[model samples]
Target: MFLLPVLLLLSSCQETIESKDWDTIEMPRVSVHDPSITSVTEDGEEVFYIFGSHLAQAKSKDLVNWEVPFQTEYEDLDNNIILGDIDKNLREAFEWAGKDDADSAGGYSIWAPDVIWNPNYKWKNGDKGAYMYYYSATSTWRRSNIGFAVSKTIEGPYTYQDTVVYSGFTQVDSTDGSDRNTHYKNTHLKKLISTGVIDEFSSNWVLNSGTEYNTDYAPNAIDPTLFYDENEKLWMVYGSWSGGMYILPIDEKTGIPMYPGVDSENQGLIVDRYFGTKLIGGYHQSGEGPYIVYDKETQSYYLFVTYGQLHSSGGYNMRLFKSDNPDGPYVDMKNQVPVFSSTDQNSQYGVKIMGNYQFSNMNKAYKSSGHNSAIITEDGQWMLVYHTRFTGGESHEVRVHPMMMNRNGWPTTLPFEYVNNEYFVSEVGDKDIIGSYEFINHGTTNDPKVLPLSTVELRADKTITGDVSGTWDKEAQSSFISFVIEDVHYEGIIVMQQDETKEQTKKIVFSAIGDNNQTIWGVKK
Candidate 1:
């Protein structure tokens, strides 16, 4: 058969990942966080940045680590970002609070912030169409209201706007007092409204289950975040302490809350309190950073919390729970409790131990590493970003670590070590720490089967055992055999390459045991 030039070319053409593509690369963030940061996350080439009324910083990275070179307040806006001077209203809004410093937010103390593109508007001119919303507390002792900011790109030098919405009033300029903006009228939000970015949320409504299902959003409720469901509708979930969290449908037309009023008319309803009921208390045992995450793999929703008291010794810890819905009946998977916790005696604290000991490698000041939010990398690895106190009494710094669900479906921060090595990789495939390979029975004649991938155990004397044990150079490269203090059978995947340029990879699984304070490899499984 004769083939045309085009047909021949098509027949010969195939996609190939060069050996260079097989290079074992990893997620770029080593420890990304803003000081006193409530959340650290990514959306695009930009690492969208906002801190607790402290600073607004952004990082841009193409492949690996985010490069954070942009940090600004109102003054640096136009020069560094797209929508810098465009939001004249935002400048007028923040003029009073004196956003120059959190301690001196004029009267506004900026809190939990969420940044996303302006869904309603496409990028053009300098307005790349990004927006930010944050809960702002005027004082440490009072309730705070959510504020607004607008920018061009996800990596923003967002323009400082005014406190469009606030707690404590329905209409800041009410005459007769029947404006029906009551959803925000009574709460700390009073009647302030958040301008939820258009693209990030659902523009939908729920069928009435009961009057208790307000489904109305509030401006005053704290820790507000604008998110979208898989269906691409815009939704806003916000609230703090006394009211719990609420989810309300949004008006795509105006970026405002859409709710049915008492008249069953557009009396303007609010979101139903989604998490903990009034009787149930806050989502966290107390409610601080009520961040939500969606698991694409399981199609489940996760609400993460920074629980307990960081002021106490060994108190602060990052905790989380899951549910089938975004606005959920979030339950702590580990305990079936209402909220996530690590108060358990055996393995309560969920902070990632950086070295052999908590105080050994990390800063000794382990006062708190709580307030957390979850993010998935572009490559799809889950990471939890939280702040840990410096061990030696330094300023609280933020850190990022890979996270995962345990065999029990509960979430756990990646441990500090893997395969007995201090640093660990969190990718799959013939990459650094995952791949299919052979197993050699070296530990006694029992030759018990290893967990899944090839596994070997090394005794306390530091020797390989179980399936296979030999001086073979190849086995060492492909995998490793390690052990814990209990001197039981343990194994791990050792990422080795043939002089660092080969695509070959292997999985070496091992077992270990230990209390929460330590790990000891034991038993097969």
Candidate 2:
């Protein structure tokens, strides 16, 4: 009888050791377009915040569970916690760049606001606060101006400060003599001339005198993203389609541009003295929403930008480039430099990190996954935050994906939406990786069409067969994996994550980037 009891106890212990108690985690969803993410400490707890276009804002303690604190509709302006009264408070910006109903029938076209805590910024009362860099645009694509606002807290009733950069100004304005040129001269050029950043006779001093408003050369002056370099120097990268993107060093004390003097020698296409340095995308090529983050481990500055339009049918997708210096000769995985003139296509430029794609398990295919912001968490975890639209409609939702650098020091996102601790793979064995999977090869295309998932099987003999042929292997005692598919070498990281599309079933997944810069993702069936 005692022997029987011992055997029962051993069997129960073995059962307990083999089975896992998976947690049921439900994530709260929010719709915030052009989401710019930042973190702060609130009530002694860490909270992640995302502020986006049209005054939309949301907060979360754990990234999965979000609470939207502000709405995006124009009718809800009064309820906005960031800019309390949009019309009254932002009247100056409206007068400068807001579109009239005759123009677009929309209220103010506020867009792409980025917030950062600036300890160096001293308010009127000598208190420091977070700075909100925002833009206002008229119906005209290039007609916009970038400005800043200040608030005592991250979630703020921010007060407008000043409008810094202006675009789309012409030689003449309205018949009332309030022309764009006059406005530019009085509001911006006078300061630039006074500071010796530009000469009074310089063509750039007058918007119409040169191609300043020309979409082919000059920037659209929107979508501002601020970041600090390794030396803690503050810099701002802003611009959109029409011209390419540009970067300007910021004055940390005043929270404005520290003009890099003038670049009179070479007016070709690259550097601009008054507007700053042009990093990539020019001559009206399709590229916008430039975001840069420095990885300490790789010691490189990664620049991410989206190509195509923002609409659901538009071929909006995220691309990646990197450089040793912040102001860069940024190159893609294929080592191709960004196109400066309209002669070359932008789809052939940057590493197309992700485009529209869908797995077999997904109900709807995701489309236009662009305008992203990435952050390295306090605990050194990298995450990509972006807005993605679906196939059925233009409606969008925010998504967070955990990121990992491959053996080549290139960053690739995991195959699923982040779920707190459920996605962490401590030690994945060969049994976990060898199985049939739904695969997606995110090819180097900047299109709105979704890449449909196909089937692939990983056999015990280290061979892959099905939709594509390949040979796979994993590093001993590590989650890193390698595959040679049809002569292309691919490196990736594998993890066991709960499949959100399937009834939260735990499954193994892999996200890998190929030698040609194309990305491939797999979810085990």
Candidate 3:
């Protein structure tokens, strides 16, 4: 009788273990265009905060579920979140790049603000606070200025400091009483002359006229982002279509740029003492929103930039490049440099990480997935934060995707949206991973076309078939995978995640990067 009872107990325990379900949670959504993310500790709990265009701000304890605390409408600027009285606090910036009316196309024209907790930032009372670097741009693409503000807290009633950089200046002011030469002299001309960028301010040098202003050497002075390298030295990278991207070393103590002297040696890209050193994108190239993150594990700084236009139909997509130095000669996997001296053929440069894509299980396709910010979690897991507009309308929402570094040190984003601690890779066996899958190869084409998923199969005999032909193998007791398809060698990782289109169903997934610098994603079906 005792033996019979023991056997029944063991059988029941086995059944319970097999029937255990994976934890599933719903992710809350918020829309913040050009979202720039950072983290802070609040009340002993870690919170992720994203600050974006139009003075939009949101925070979250878990990366997936967000709560928007402050948002400002374009028409209603009286109740601004950062500036209590926008017309009073940011009067100087408005005088430079304000919209024509309340209902302008740029929506108040404040775009892509990046916030950071600067411990070295000295306040009136000598206490440190958060620094917010933002840009104000007019409807004109090249007309913009980048400024900064300070606050004791992350969500703040910030006080404007000054406009640090200016662009789109001519010999005289515009008809709207916007004096370009005066603003340029007040902000950068003095330094430029002092540093020998120019002998003296003349109309030929100060005036931005014709196609040369947008194509040759003028930086738009927008999309500012800040980061500290391995040495903890602060640096800012900002610019856009007009003259590509530029970087400046920042003074941590003063919370301003420690602008470099003239690049007499004529190094990599041209160095404009006023706008810093050019990284990439010139000749009216359609690239913007440059963000850089230093990965300790890889011992490299990864530079991410978006190409094409940002609208629903404008082929917006994200690309990646890596460098050994902070201010880099960043190169893609194919060893191609992103520096463009002449006309821009963006699709021919950089490692395209993501583009407009749709899975078989999704209700709608995703487009314009660009302008991203990245963060490494306390546990050392990498996560990507960006705004994605879906098809059917211009509506957008924030998405957080977990990323894994491949054997080659390239980061590959997972196939599905991240669910807090629910998508961690376990010790999966070959039998569990062998099945049908929907595959998406994110090509290097920069267009508004959405690539739908195609059916593929991973057989138990280490072979892949159907839409593509490949041989695959998983490392012993590891999530790392190696495969080859159509002469392209890929290295990646595999994990089990929730099938976003299906309710509560767990599925196998994989993300890999090929030697050609293109990324591929798969979702088990």
Deviation of model 2 at 334, angstroms: 1.3
lDDT of 2 by residue, 238-350 (tens): 88887788888888778878765666432333567667878888778888888999898899999989988888888889998988888777888787768476687888777
Best of the two (1, 3) by lDDT: 3
TM-score of each: 0.53, 0.88, 0.88
Candidate 2 residue pairs in clash (backbone atoms < 3 Å): 173-179, 244-281
lDDT of 2: 0.74
Sorted on lDDT, best first, the list reads: 2, 3, 1
* Tens digits of per-residue lDDT for model 1, 1-525: 000000000011113211111111233332323222223345434342434322233342322243343322322322323223322423333332223323332222344556544456333453333454443433211123555555443444454444533332322322111222222234322222233222211222111321111222222245556566656566556554333345555444344554422112111223232121211122223434556667677777666654444332334544455667655555542224342223323123222122111311223333456556566655665666665554444245445554544333334444322111123332322232222223321211111122122444433333445554422111233333233323332323232211111221222223221122222222222
Model 3: residues >4 Å from true position, as ranges?
1-27, 70-76, 101-107, 171-183, 190-214, 265-267
On the 0 to 100 scale, the lDDT of residue 452 in model 1 is 26
The stretch of ten residues in a row with the least summed lDDT in candidate 3 is 1-10
- Candidate 1 lDDT at 352 equals 19
Candidate 3, residue 125: lDDT: 75
Residue range 196-299, candidate 3, lDDT tens digits: 75555433234344212333566777889999999998889888876688888887766777655544313566666557778888777778889999999999
